[model samples]
Target chain A: AQSVTQPDIHITVSEGASLELRCNYSYGATPYLFWYVQSPGQGLQLLLKYFSGDTLVQGIKGFEAEFKRSQSSFNLRKPSVHWSDAAEYFCALTYLCYNNNDMRFGAGTRLTVKP
Target chain B: EAGVAQSPRYKIIEKRQSVAFWCNPISGHATLYWYQQILGQGPKLLIQFQNNGVVDDSQLPKDRFSAERLKGVDSTLKIQPAKLEDSAVYLCASSFGTDTQYFGPGTRLTVL
Candidate 1:
């Protein structure tokens, strides 16, 4: 079974500070990885995805994720954190098998921005 | 382009009652998905539809839960004799053939 693990349940960082959220996956083959952000009372929005090619992938809202095959990790990073960036972050994996896509998400990490 | 749309952002019902949720996916999206998201947990896929046909429903509880995607555009999920454990946010998402899925604002269901 393919699964994603977000080790951080909650993270607090000062405004303008750098941020990194750890994610690890258990899968035998290369998997499609994604990062999604969910704000309170709103639907989740896609931040970035890594299908293939370059390991470092850029996404919306000044977010980026690096997929490391060796570590089986796809960590999300941002150069500077903002108050608006405080939300629940989820790392997801999608496996394509027999023309069907099965997607799964991690438990999610809630980020808090401190002044 | 319009994003996915869902109705009745919130619903409150007593246990053993029944409830239904509606979803309208983006135009031209062939794949539709329904997910259940309990508080403090990630969303779990309950069912998947490919152009009005059931593609994957292994996770869906067939006894009291049912869903349909008619015309391959709009879809509905219903739960009968809702249990306390069924209280969760129901999310609907759609994607173009094997593409990234776009989600709609979920419908929060509370079983008293």
Candidate 2:
């Protein structure tokens, strides 16, 4: 079974500060990784995805994630944080089983921005 | 393009009551999904459909939950004899193939 782990329960950062959200996954085969953001009262939005190729993948809203196979990790990063960026972030793994695709999501990390 | 659409943004019912939620996927989307998201946790896949055919439903609790996408366009999820633990957001999503899925606003189900 494929599982995703986001160690951070909540994180607080001041505006303009750098931010990083940790994510780790456990899967037998090479995994398809993704980062999603959910604001209050809204559905989950795709931040980015990592299928193959580049280890570091850029996403919308100045977000990026690096897939590290050695560490079994895909950490989301941003150079500067904005107030609007405060939201719940989730890491998910897409598993392909016998031509069927299933997505498993992590517990998610709640981000809060301080001004 | 328009994203996935779901109806009844919020619903409240007492335990053991029955409720149903609806979803309309994007135009030409061949895949649709239903997920249950408990508060403070990530969404869990309840069922998946590919062009009006059942693909995966291993995690769905068949005893009280059922879903169908008849025309491969719109779908409905029904839950009977709901439990307190069933209080959560039911998310509907759709995709063109196996790529990124676009999600709906979600139907918040509350059991009293």
Candidate 3:
């Protein structure tokens, strides 16, 4: 079985400040990683993804994540956060199921950015 | 692109009652997903469909929950007898392939 762990349950940062959310996964082989954000009463939107190659992937809303093979981590970071950045963040890992299925998500982290 | 679409944005039902949710994936998307999101928890993959076929459904509670994706386009999820623990948001998502999954607004199910 595969699982993802988002260490930070909740995080707070002031507006315009930098922010980082930690994520780690337990997979047997190479894993495809992704980050998603959900605003209040809204659907989940993609932030970024890492399939392979250089490892550093940039996404919408000025978000970026770097996949580390050694660390089993794919942390999301934003140089500056806006008040609207307050939302729930999730990390995921993609792998095939018994009959070649795909993707699974983490527990999630609630982000609160103050003004 | 219209993105994924789900009906009945909110639903309220008593325990032992039955309810059904619908979803229509993007026009050409081949992969569709159903997720269960409990309060204070992340969305869990309940089922996945590749076109009109089932790809994965191990996590889905087969005892009271059933789903189907007919014609490889639209889908429906049915709960035979709702339980209090079944109260949660049912999210529908789709992907062009297996690359990225896009989610819909979700159906908030409240079972009392």
- For residue A73, give model 2's deviation from the true position in Å: 0.5
Q: Which candidate number would show the highest DockQ if scored against the true structure? A: 1
Q: Candidates' lDDT values, in order?
A: 0.95, 0.95, 0.91
Q: What TM-score, to 2 decimal places, does chain A of model 3 have?
A: 0.94
Cα lDDT tens digits, model 1, A81-111, are: 9999989999999988865777999999999
Clashing residue pairs found in predicted model 3: A97-A101
Candidate 2 has an fnat equal to 0.74
lDDT of 3 by residue, A42-92 (tens): 889999988889889999999999999999999999999999999999998
True contacts kept of each: 0.74, 0.74, 0.62
TM for every model, in the order presented, reads 0.99, 0.98, 0.97
Report how far residue B17 has shifted in candidate 2, in Å: 1.0
Off by over 4 Å in 1: none
What docking grade applies to model 2?
A: high
lDDT of 2 by residue, B34-53 (tens): 99999999999999999999
By lDDT, the better pick of 2 and 3 is: 2
Clashing pairs in 2: none
By TM-score, the best candidate is 1
Model 2 residue runs over 4 Å out of place are none
Which candidate would rank higher by TM-score, 1 or 3?
Answer: 1
